[model samples]
Target: MTPKLKEDAQRLVIYIGESDRWRGKPLYAAILETLKAEGLAGATVIRGVAGFGAHSHIHTAAILRLSEDLPLIIHVIDTPEKIEHALELVRPMVREGLITLEDVRVVRYTHRYLNPLPADRLVEEVMTREVETLSPEMTVAAAWQKMLETLIKAMPVVDNSGQVLGMVTDEDLLERAGLQQRLSVAERLDKPLLDEEIARLRQSPLRVADVMSKPPITAQAREPLGLAAMRMAKHGIKRLPVLNDQGQLMGVLSRVDILRLLSEKPAMKMTAPLGATQTVRDVMTPVIPAVQQDDELPEIVEKLLESGTHRVIVLDGFGKAIGLISDSDVVARIQPSQRRGVIAALFGDALAPSSSVTAAELMSPGVLTARPETSLVQAARMMMNPKRKWLVVVDEQDKPLGLVDRHILLRALTAG
Candidate 1:
């Protein structure tokens, strides 16, 4: 139970019958609608996978099962005062099932706002603008180097005009390399024309465009985080690029940035709703860590984690964000042999692996970037749509700046 649960407020669990003949749809809808009308904070409905109660019968193996046989669970969290008021109407009508009450603690809560004002807020006040980027012409070697130098898992690929072309990820690079390695030995030993095949493999040209994912998704600097999260969930992406009104790249956003903003202690209390008076700049992490576009993966990882942070920004020689690297990127680059060796060391073997892997072996060359003044809400939306956890802050020159996490935004909201 959450310690914050108002003594007068209680968490309620209401179970209803699952008979197909009964008004199941109406009942479920009524329960939810009533809860909302009564102004309860929130309610959840769970459909049972398989279970039976009071009837004492096994209920599986049915093709066209009706509503009566199905099970429904309803849970509502709110102040005891609200619960009791709503229960007054619920208790009389619900006669057959179970109605229980419990005390619990809510780690965080937010006051719902109906009509929020926007004048006091601007996108820049909350958007994270620092970012990293990558180019399409870089090789696997150069991409890997950038990852090591920046410590980001994925990078946005963009063109000279500052428009995003696509996105490249560490996973994509490693998967390609691993597949090539698997084919190498087989072709070398099993084929009668091994020499010819080897020559072809060596001569093969690898370009960023060959491996990059195109048609990148983007967000405006004024969009809200809630909408951003919905887009991310629907599209199954990890990050979104932030763009200005002119469609110029401004920054990148990831899930971690949103989480950083939401998880902060100050935002936990129900007060003004998020985005009421906030802007992207107000919540963005300003001091971005970055690496050159030509750097390698090993170096990117080293520098990204040097400050004990999990991510870093990538930039070109001129200082624009080219991409980002994260702990997950590093993990993706590890080979089975390396994993075994690292595990062996955990069991007391003191010797380190002999190979000297460089960042150029692990990073993606192309990167996506954003402007420093982009809105935090828009950034969060982009991160959620793409399912990414980090974003790079950058300048107009496309130079890498800082990194932002979702949690930071949530914190700012709570504090404000």
Candidate 2:
């Protein structure tokens, strides 16, 4: 738990000699390390020009008579409980020194420049309060309806007490049961086919507990947003169920929520030169999947499958991105008869055969583009539109250089 300072705080002052040693190390340094390990708010060490101790021997830093044992004072301020705890651990470390404790008022405390990004913000400030959760006994069909209504790819499974048991994602439904397609593809499906899919799910006896991933990863509402973002990136998850001290679900935190915060703040003015600071080129993934404009539908699907991505960029004869192809675009634009087979092929059910439908016929022409020198915040602002996801970094000739998505930006933001 993080220690907080109230109107009344305790200030601990320790006076020792610079030459004092603790287990072959400086006493002042040892005391500071101990306080830090104990999680005190903070500590500061100051060296005095001249001072006298119990022996009445004065130590001075005068040019003519420089003393080896200069007086040092360590200052620590925090709540009374924390100061008392620290005193117990630090008292034994000092063989001979003067320690004093007093009441003090804290005017203000801040850690503005500690991080390159605005990581000091709290999780509760940005987490989604009205999280859509699933019950353990709920049927798979019921969970699907809730997900479709909220447009959420994943949801937390909880019991009557709202304690999260696990997580259920669209992939869980398709893999655990015989569900035909993902939620996105299912939404694009025809009315009768969608009804049929739901009916198929309703026939199964599987409940949310049967499909949810157990031992859910979670975050605390009081923790820093940066810590939560790091957990998300490390686990390769898009969102986390935020919980309170009692382990009850309070909200949900997603990668978009963090990026949205970045979008609203001013550009972080790092100390590095303008050109030396981070940019699209610093974190983007090069060698992205691409398809030619005249490429057939089968070739485009092959590109998506091989690259393990949901979309592919379509380039013109001059090697410039003209449009983009996504699974949704294919399902929405292609003939109804071929939709089932294409969806199957996309999820690795089978390889989709070649067809006369050209990439030009199914691609969305307005492709989002960026430059190598674009700042991460600028790229984040461009992707705020719900319709845009991928930002293709291009060269002067408008050719592809790399790709930047929410995942990439989130990783960059959490990086030290």
Candidates in order, TM-scores: namely 0.37, 0.73
Clashes of each: 127, 0
> Total backbone clashes of model 1?
127
Question: Pairing residues by index, what is the TM-score of model 1?
Answer: 0.37
- Best candidate according to lDDT: 2
**Candidate 1 global lDDT:** 0.57
**257-286: candidate 2 lDDT, tens digit per residue:** 888887788755654444434578878999
Among all windows of 10 consecutive residues in model 1, the one with the lowest summed lDDT is 179-188
By summed lDDT, the worst window of 10 consecutive residues in model 2 runs over 108-117
- Candidate 1 local lDDT, 258-372, one digit each (tens): 4444333132255543333344544567776665655654455446545555556665566665556554444445564564343232222333344455444445544544566
